[model samples]
Target: MGSLSRHWPRIAVTLIPLVFALLHATGALHLGVLQRLDDIIYDARLRATMPRTLDERIVIVDIDEKSLDEIGHWPWGRNRVAEMVDELFDRQQASVLGFDVVFAEADESSGLKRLRQLAQAELKDQPGFVERLNQMQASLDYDALLAKSLQKRPVVLGYYFTGETQAKGVLPAPVMRRSELQGRPIRFIGWSGYGANIEQLATQAPMAGFFNPVVDSDGVLRAIPLLSEYKGEYYEALSLAMYRLLVGLPEVAPGFPREKFFGSRSYGGLESVLLRHPKGTVAIPVDDKVSSLVPFRGAGGVSGGSYRYVSAADVIGRRLPPGSLKDKIILVGTTAQGLLDLRATPVGEAYPGVEAHANVISGLLDGKVLFRPDYAVGYDAVVLLLAGLTLAFTLPLLSATRAVLASAAVIAALVSLNVYLYSAEGLVLPLAAALVMCITAFALNMSYGYFVESRSKRELANLFGTYVPPELVDEMVKDPEAYSMKAANKELTVMFCDMRGFTKMSERMEPTQLQELLNAVFNRLTDIISSNRGTIDKYMGDCVMAFWGAPVDIPHHAPLAVKAAIEMAGAVRQINEEHRAKGIPEIGIGIGLNTGTMCVGDMGSENRRAYTVIGDAVNLGSRLEGLSKAYGVEIVASETTRKQAPDFAWQELDRVRVKGKEQAVAIYRPLAPAAGLERPLLDELKAWGAFLRAYRAQDWEQSDVLMLNLQRMNAKKYLYELYSERVASMRLLPFDPEWDGATNFETK
Candidate 1:
């Protein structure tokens, strides 16, 4: 089951494309599916047009929700609509007007019929009779009045057709009728009769066409059926006929050059309609099947709004001004509830039916329409394969970061090419497919990277000794590349601090109390070290081994080490106070510091490893701690560490050779030399230093004179006894030529 589930994606890959091809080839493309494709195209194209700020020539007069409630239902009387037309042509001076609505019926109400009945003397008081007469006269079915109005100027009417058996409209003559269907009687369905105004309207304004929508499978209108054939006849759409008539071009077929059809000069399916503007005939490419792709510019039409709609109910009253219908072409239609013209579209859901026609006309005017040809499919297949294969092959070979960057690069490349084709060549490639493929490859690679790295992290962190610090586990994961189990020379200040006489203290306390007390002390000391940016190397029983400047850089390593030593001593004092309060024995701490090159890294055998500092410097630091008690101090450092930390006051102890090193080096006790008189104490130390040198040279008179004067000046002196004892011992040992001031201590 697991294997089948894993391979299910491949099975789907093989089946889906075959299904897509079958649907396309079988002529099952419907209004619903085509709409979905149109929506996808709209989503991408609209993103491209986001940056445009202004367009100058187009203007939109809104017929908003305000106008709808101001009026009642749609399809008002024709005389009032004629007034609106006069207003636009005469007052607004609009160069041309195209009607998005259709006039399938006519209005015939005139004021004279209602006026006659109300004037009779007897009927005035009879309320019921007067009401019936008003209703009768108010309903003057005037196809004649509207026809006379149409004669005043150019006007176009709109209509539509259905391919079903219940389709309406008389068959118009087919333009490209072939003799191949010879002797086969063709049946045509059409409108049996039209409330057509022939004398006044049709004679003056002769252009008319259908407005049937070519919907896709998703109920989206992506194209217009430019020409429909039935019973050896053809008819035009409403927008096409009006456009053809206004341009004064041949309506049967627009004269497009044959080369335009072969090359890039595209055209719609209808006859070549010369643009009324200076632009010559537009090439509209209708497939051999008599359908044309509607080149939709976008949702925003003239003045960035759709068509201007005047409510029919509002026009019936004098709501619109005079001269409303002067020279404009008025096509009238309905926009009432229950009329059911609303369609779901990308830009809007409640879009009026007539607005779709307006969008087409606007596209025609702006030349912003993007049409798809049958040839685009073949071109896109090659593009998708190239884009997909490139990412799939490259992703596995690169690191996670590089793979992400490459994926973005591929997406950007595909988008740039798509946009370039749109602007330069008027061709739109299938960009979404390539983007999907790039994302797929990137996702796969990153998922695999995470899976592989997760195991490595657990393995690497576990390799650290079981008792090692948990913090080291995280550092190993963040960068396993820089870490090496082998040691390397690193300059650091290593600290080895231990508690004095811990075994005696532990023996007196209970096991739980001892454990708890140790935890409390260690936790406090460790926190102090970390706060100073010192990496705790390891903990050995009650002792701590820490260092500065490893796995990360700490610039003031010497000062930090000195400060940590002081804080640990203070903590020991606090811990001893707590022990006294609890009636337990007190504990003291000793800290030693050394500065030199040390071997630092994760060190140990395969079973146990530690990130620590080790070398002669580490050994010296541990050795220095043993000498602290003899010097009557808590913190001590070798000469190298003392010199590095010049800010601290110190008392120089005698030169000492540690257990491991034969070379004798000076050591110092880290102590506050003078609380209020630093210069005085410093002067005394310098004089004592002079005296010590004299005594070493066997000049007893000068040594005795300098010590007596220092003692008299500094009465509370702490190092005075040490100097006196050193002088007494030197005199007793006598004057050997090999004598060096090397002192050895045995107590902690």
Candidate 2:
């Protein structure tokens, strides 16, 4: 049962990872951190497996530095664009031409509108008359020329949508209308405003697509919407519209899974985007939001060789080979730094925006678009559950090395399987949640084993650090398994010390000053006992209760207790000398020591417990401390302690039946170190012992003579003077025949 109890923490921490896994499985929690990490992992795998070769099916007519140098900067005149359009189809013989640019505003850079306004207001009568004006009107109207060039051509114009309230320019007919969706369950991204080509240019172009890329919170272009809805009408993306035109103008429709496939749910969103044409049905992959992951075909444009790029200036100037763009899907866009058409993608940071559309076009043509199905959540949850449970049960049963190796194998398997699904099956599945759970479970187990399971040393420190000396505690900690604080009867030494006149001293000083003085006295007295290797049980007011043995055994507790009592008496005198010099009140203390078998251990109520001793021996020690005032001595000890420490000079204080005790016990005062005392003091001690014998024997006259000699040698020795008065008073009273010279302390 004890061994089983130690494993409880390991079992509890293991359930933590399982809880997270369960929450994720139930869709009650969405770990966005894990999702983002999985996104990064998917990107790395995508980049590692991408075919880094050029696709000659699509070519970009880049308005590069060379083109800008020759063509005189951006927003070029309409006639210049018209000339490039003619150059691509008529001269270069391109199969299809798409504009990755917008013609939202009229091309007023031609100065044609200004010239007409001037002709109507100021220069109406100044030109070569109406004939010359009419002839220059046809030549200067560049918008008309550009519009005519676009008429009846396979040109796909690009535009963008905005979150603004007001729409801009003219939008073409939508591919699908809201009325067509009628009750069908499908989700489409909605927009508030759009920027399309002007009326003439839009009507003249064969088709147009909004080239806006949907950026994520982390500012990465990962997924794009093939179709978006605005004002109850649906518009196609630049890539989607271009793919449609390339595939013989397929009709756009929403594809849905069978009703049996979705079960009880009201809607399952879009399953795929259908491209219906004369040949058959071509299903383009799309998620619930009708968005597809951008299948990046390596880094494209000028830096990487994913697509061939030709300068628009060279094409317009007829400087390139005749069939340079022959039968190629030509996309007209800018690679100039000033255009700001670069984007952050999986392959590179400054990925060409035009090349992004090209990759989508190629992906749709090749049917290689990645899909994240509705069942991906279920798939991830199952993996997380299995991995978490496996690690939870396995780690605790194995050693550290084997546990780590097992965790590594689990993580490697998960990653390998996820990557295989991504590369071979074109599936986008989550991987981070399960991997993090496995690693976290393993770490929790290892940390618990290292810190909590191996805690014997900490237990020892906790038990003895507060009571015993630091050196003793250090030694006990080294062999903690051999000791415990359990109550038991053990022969030990216990001491109690209390300050005399503390109540009156406290009344004379401020509270703070009294507290500081008390702290100084106790700190000094405690150091004396601690230096002698005694365990301090507690400090109660101005008194200190301490015991030696039990918490850690000491074979010679009696001598240690006696030695500590002697030092405590000397320490009080030294303290008083320092206090008298500082004009502070001096203090004094009385200590009592005893040696006997007593019960000792951690004892108290449930609210608080203290590692201490309790029994008759401990109580007698406290009573003896109180008797020190009556005996006129600094220290009082039981005869048991006096007999054990023979190296100390002893003065028999009394034989008394203390309160709550029937037996009369002999008590004595420890005078000083026997080796250091002079012969005169020894002679005084001899005279005092003889006086005690005579007084107890009822020989009052002889006892009086002995006490008088003791007082004459030391006139300030009030104890002998006290005995002289007692002997005189006893002579007048009737003596009992049963009297044994044992005093009875009835009040305690």
Q: Across residues 510-603, which tens digit of lDDT does each residue of candidate 2 receive? A: 9998999899899999998888889989999999999887577888888888998988999999989998899887877889899998998889
Clashes of each: 47, 0
Q: Write the per-residue lDDT of candidate 1 for residues 1-748, one digit (tens) a residue.
A: 4554554454344334333333432335333343344359655575455333432233233333444566434554565556555555555444445444545533434554445556466567776766666565534535444555555555565555544454322222334352533333322223333322334444455655666677665566656665555444556666566555555644354323243332323322232222333454466544434444444434533233334445544544445666554333343444443556655454545545555555555555555555554444444555656655566556555667887888788788877887787776555445544454456556654554243277767776665534234565565666666655557897899998888767897778788888888888899998888777777887888888888876554566888788889888988999889889988788878789998899887777789767777787888898888777666678889888888877777767678777767788898876652345467767877886787687667666687788888888775655666777677667766577776667655332
Query: Which 10-residue span in candidate 2 carries the lowest summed lDDT?
Result: 258-267
Count of clashes in candidate 2: 0
Which regions of candidate 1 fall more than 4 Å away from where they truly are? 1-38, 47-72, 82-99, 105-141, 166-204, 251-280, 285-338, 441-748
Q: Give the Cα RMSD of candidate 1.
A: 32.0
Candidate with top lDDT is 2
